[model samples]
Target: MAGFGWATHSAHKHSANRHHLRTKARMDAGFRQMNGNLERKGSLTSSYLEEPLNKTGVVSCIFSLKQEVGALVKALRLFEEKGINLTHIESRPSRNNKEEYEFFISVDQLSSKALDEVVDGLRTQISGQVHELSRNKQKDTVPWFPNDIQDLDRFANQILSYGSELDADHPGFTDPVYRARRKEFADIAYNYRHAQVIPRVEYTAEEKYCGYREDNIPQLEDISHYLQTCTGFRLRPVAGLLSSRDFLAGLAFRVFHSTQYIRHSSKPMYTPEPDICHELLGHVPLFADPSFAQFSQEIGLASLGAPDEFIEKLATVYWFTVEFGLCKEGNEVKAYGAGLLSSFGELQYCLTDKPKLLPFEPEKTCQQKYPITEFQPVYYVAESFEDAKEKVRKFASIIPRPFSVRYNAYTQRIEVLDNTQQLKNLADSISGEISILCTALRKME
Candidate 1:
């Protein structure tokens, strides 16, 4: 929900307001001309113009630069000479070569002919395997994450088939309700014990992980149990119809996909808002992993009393990592983020040779922009769970908050480290409520 500041790569665009205005004027005129052509020559229009131009007004280019020191400078010079305004440029470790880097660049849009010429030039001067992702624009529509349990069940058979096709193991096979749902999907739940995409747990975390998955279609009670058993986080359900909370008491799963809110009937995969599917499928899976739970709680804890600016940064980090993050498993990149996991279209598209994959760096990850309406144009890939947690810790520490937090798994309380007795006492009061709620929640098991 935070607005991210992107550093422009073009020196001209950074300082020259005149140049920026000129570019805008040219783009507007081009759009107008194209629109007029469509209206005047409706029957005789070219098939090429029939394809909608990218209204995002940006083009992403991924290319490898020669290892030479001057390679980047030469590439920049080419863009400058062509009057191509670049919004962003960053380099990441190439998948194949350690010595070289894959440069991801975003530039202002140009006409099709001009864009084609730029791609040709980059391929000739830069690496031969330059990839320009599909620039085709989708018809604008309201985006949502599926939330309804009943609605999700409508695709149970389809999901089961897809899971079997991928040889995926369904979580929560032990519960009768889960087994019943699995039966509807031809017993896809009992196909395997667990998913290979998740990290392997040692003997210590194994018991708690299994306990978290006791119920396949978890209720608020089940989720509360999972949170306490696995992560020591609490689940606080909302009371009223209209609510202002993004997350309840800094950590609860705020239900956004209920009957009260708007729902998408025609587009099964698309949700106009975050649904229960996004919470259960997208988020809860990672909670089963201990280290990931700690990382997530740290973000939640940091958000408790932080300033709006720092909270925004925390939100950005959460968005990129917890919501849309990918991690490397052996030689493969797998999605663990709820946003990617819940959306079938994006789940497959992300792993394909489509979106740009960059190594997980907290600084860069938080700064990158994402598209919610279409397939993500870029994703940050983590080396491992430990790597992600360490990076998150480093980033969290830099947040300019006045207090520190510590969670007691034994008492199910969050303790605040602060100078003010008033604030400390306030935190203690909340911790007491959490302790009581957690005790009752655990009893549901």
Candidate 2:
């Protein structure tokens, strides 16, 4: 809603309706082309104009076209003529020109002369402008942002599986038996689907490294259900480490991406990275507390579309608070951070005078640097979870983003509040809920 400008109701309604019409027309044409191809080929596989070439790499091209019937199909026909194999295709309404749509296609890489010919043909023939997106530009582009919960499947292979490529200094780097067991856990996580019952793991004696008794090791499904009931937080299995942006985005949807593997037995009480021990003993319990869950989600919401520098700052804030934070328990400081709770050595060491303890301040805490593989030299202590949440909420207000987003529970989708219609729809839903509450109160009286 940040960039929206005030406009007359009639003008706003007209614009919204026009936009809807254009979207519907584009979809209709796409469906018609698909159906025609299906009818001709009699199957989806045979519908391709050319078989994929034995190319070593892929190339992405983007083009824009004025709104016209059969325009998209005509462009596809050009690719067929050039014997170019399209691997993927997507289209979106152009932001710069409302009268046109931008099309993105990934095709098998071609020689410079052939690629230039294809581009020239499109420019002179169907599409007015066509350009190949450079690979470096693709990497620098905005990271893929998920709009739906199921889109998380895209990150399944985002990291190495089972720590198979662990550093030489890692405790499990040379332990084949430990690495084999990790692969088993990784397999389970890889096949997991959204909304499916979470698979349970029976931890071996050596795997219970988080100081929890064997009987106290709750099943992942049970913890997921408890968190869902108490604070709308649930868990999904992750392969391994995620980029800070991807991990924080899961919080926006009240989802936590947890690892299934246990740490190496050699270092039962310590781990270089998060494993099931850290997830269960340190993170799961705090998520059941509503105040802490809200605080966690606030950090996540602030990361969405934030600039790279701000993302680094937010990751630092998370490192200090969620990973290694402390809280005042009346007169004593208690460990609340997952890193402190999961590591026996750090848990006791943090409470001692050896480490510097400072009051939690988002402004300063985000700037403090700490060690990753060793005990934290500094810890930020908050008075209460609620206090931390409020401080973080204020801190998030200054993050630079063009629009605000809200998670719509009913649809399970993130609604970008960038238009008048979206605001009106949210207001109507709230009013209806308030009316229901008032009626119930009156009846009780």
Taken over the whole model, the C-alpha lDDT of each candidate is 0.46, 0.63
Residue 28 in candidate 2, Cα distance off native in Å: 36
The residue-by-residue lDDT of candidate 2 on 205-296, one tens digit each, is 76665445646466778888988999999988876655566667678788888877766776655455566666877788888988888898
Residue 191, model 1: lDDT of 26
Give lDDT for model 1. 0.46
* lDDT tens per residue, model 1, 57-122: 665556666577788887777777777777867666653344566676766656433556566776
Point out where model 2 deviates above 4 Å. Answer: 1-142, 160-162, 202-211, 215-217, 329-332, 433-445
Residue 367, candidate 2: Cα error in Å is 1.8
What residue pairs are clashing in model 2? none
- What are the per-model C-alpha RMSD values against the true structure? 23.7, 14.6
**TM-score per candidate, chains pooled:** 0.43, 0.66
